[model samples]
Target: MSDSIFSIPIIAGTFLLAGVVKGVIGLGLPTVAMGLLGLVMPPVQAAALLLVPSLVTNLWQLLAGPRFGALLRRLRGMMLGIALGTVAGSGLIAGPATGAATTALGLALAAYAVVGLFGPALRVPPRAEPWAGPVLGAVTGVVTGATGVFVIPAVPYLAALGLARDDLVQALGLSFTVSTLALAAGLFWHDALPLQAAGASLLALVPALAGMALGGWLRARVRPGTFRLCFFLGLLALGGELAWRGLG
Candidate 1:
């Protein structure tokens, strides 16, 4: 991998910021990292370069030791949906189709954020069965595979669950870890995982880990509503960037 003087510093800062956000909010690293990295590299390369750091950070999130079994039982159906959607989306990562799909995904996320900012209170009561997971998962997975934009419908569902802060963070971390791994595997199978890109991604772990540590500390003191608003706004900015890149 050829080293650019700017790449490492840029990626380091991006990962640091992403890690902090993810640490505080349970999700947003990938969205924030890729969005910022895309500014420095091609979108595809930026997405590929995030694989290792994202996976590593997620591993940390999982290790923070939340109730995985309980989380799975509560969201199994949605998980399955995510899996199916990711697989399907992975299959579509070819040529212009991928670009168009990613652009749409970006727009959708931006729209979702806007709604959250102004929309009425969203409530999806705990049900014996909630079918939204499958639907949302499919969409999220497809977008993840196609563009690495994987934070759309999934966030809303988790938000609606009204989980305790820790549980919510853990759930998001686990889901992202699984989904990112699946996406990476698909890319590898297709020979889309370039060595240079992978190497850069691995290097990003340094900043990501540091940021997570800092963010975790902050999470202990930050107000939930304030943190959530920041998270949503972050999404809005990143999502808008993606939309512009894809559409422009």
Candidate 2:
């Protein structure tokens, strides 16, 4: 799938649609893009192609908030843990065993959908966050290395931090940036990412950003919770399919 000329349209369409979802919901660009792209491409290659758009968009999110210094100071531990854990698990993806990585991606997607929709509303006190942040970030980093999906515990962890609405959004950006870069490092360590994939990843930014604009327009005119429900359902179904394919 990576070598085919047809992959270009697939990549663009996937990112554009995924960007739309992210613009509307304020998250899920990589999740949705990987889920869809996984159908036609290897998870490793798909993840590689995600680098440019994902990093660019996430950096935008990271710097968009007001409390970046405060957030960075607070999340530095988690960021470091993520980097370490990704390096630790760099061998999990790409290779003859990548089917396992695909299956992990599927499970991660399903888990994220479930958690996003009905997960517990646990709260973390300041003391707990100091320890919990690094632990959860490491766990998420392992998952990201294996599957390139990093939202599971990270999102829930941030949600529990008692941050304001906008702060939470910015926090997601920062966490995503770290995760994306960590995955990039992991792919590079495994020698799984190639120059062509990087070029494709760079090209993906145009459609992704365009789709985000469209989604933002829809966001203002439509209800967010309603869109979110459908989004989770889609993730559930896609995750199941990917898992089944991986296991088969």
Candidate 3:
């Protein structure tokens, strides 16, 4: 890891911004964090710093929801697929192909941003979820392993499941939580998660929590739709630059 790129102020600030995004939108912590941090560090190192804050915050969201048990039973197969897919790509972090990982991360973010900006409010019939859930989860897990970003199809798929607003938020939390844990296991498997990175991630939690609180407060004052649009545009630009740099 580059000493300059992996500094305290940078990590703290990146996570703070990510938390704000997640707090306002109910998702985007990993996506935003990876997009920003990926500019300065390798994907695997960025992922190492991502684990703690992402896990803790999303875990709270998971347990705070109203329909925890029911959602679990409903989404079990998807969870299994996430774990399996993550295992399949575990060695990615331990490798030296920084360009490959950066390109993957950039493409994922750009695609996700495009979807958020223009994707329809799709609805998945109840009958389709049994199979659709696992397939999407596997794909999300593969993306997570490759880039440390967890949203891709998971968010859209969950939105399509016809969940109410609260359920959607909770489901995002649940899926992100599962993704975080699975990624952590993969990193640990390849010794990518060292003590220093763990400490930095933990240190970042304070700013993340504070930013979440700020975002929650802002939700009432600012127009959410506008904020969301700007956020997506920012991601699209950032992702494009990253991809261009990596490709070059």
Please give the ranking of all candidate structures by TM-score, highest first, separated by commas: 2, 3, 1
Task: Indicate the TM-score of model 1.
Answer: 0.85
Give per-residue CA lDDT, model 3, range 153-237, as digits (tens).
Answer: 8888988888988888888888898889989999998888899888888888998998899899998888999999999999999
The lDDT of each candidate is 0.75, 0.89, 0.88
Off by over 4 Å in 2: none
Tell me the deviation in Å of residue 91 in model 1.
4.4
Alpha-carbon RMSD, candidate 1:
2.7
Residues 1-248, model 2: lDDT tens digits? 35678878888999999999989999999999999988887788889989889999999988989999999999999988888887677678766686897899899999999987898898999988788989999998888888888787899999999999999999999999988988898889889988888888999999999989999999999899999999999999999999999998
Task: Judge candidate 2 at residue 23 and give its lDDT.
Answer: 95
For every candidate in turn, the CA RMSD to the true structure comes to 2.7, 1.0, 1.2
- The residue pairs that clash in candidate 2, if any, are none
In model 1, where is the ten-residue run with the lowest total lDDT?
Answer: 93-102
Pairwise lDDT winner, candidates 1 and 2: 2
Clashing pairs in 1: none
Which lDDT value does model 1 have at 16? 96
Off by over 4 Å in 1: 1-3, 91-102, 128-130, 220-231
TM-score of each: 0.85, 0.97, 0.97
lDDT for 60 in candidate 2 is 91
Better of 2 and 3 by lDDT: 2
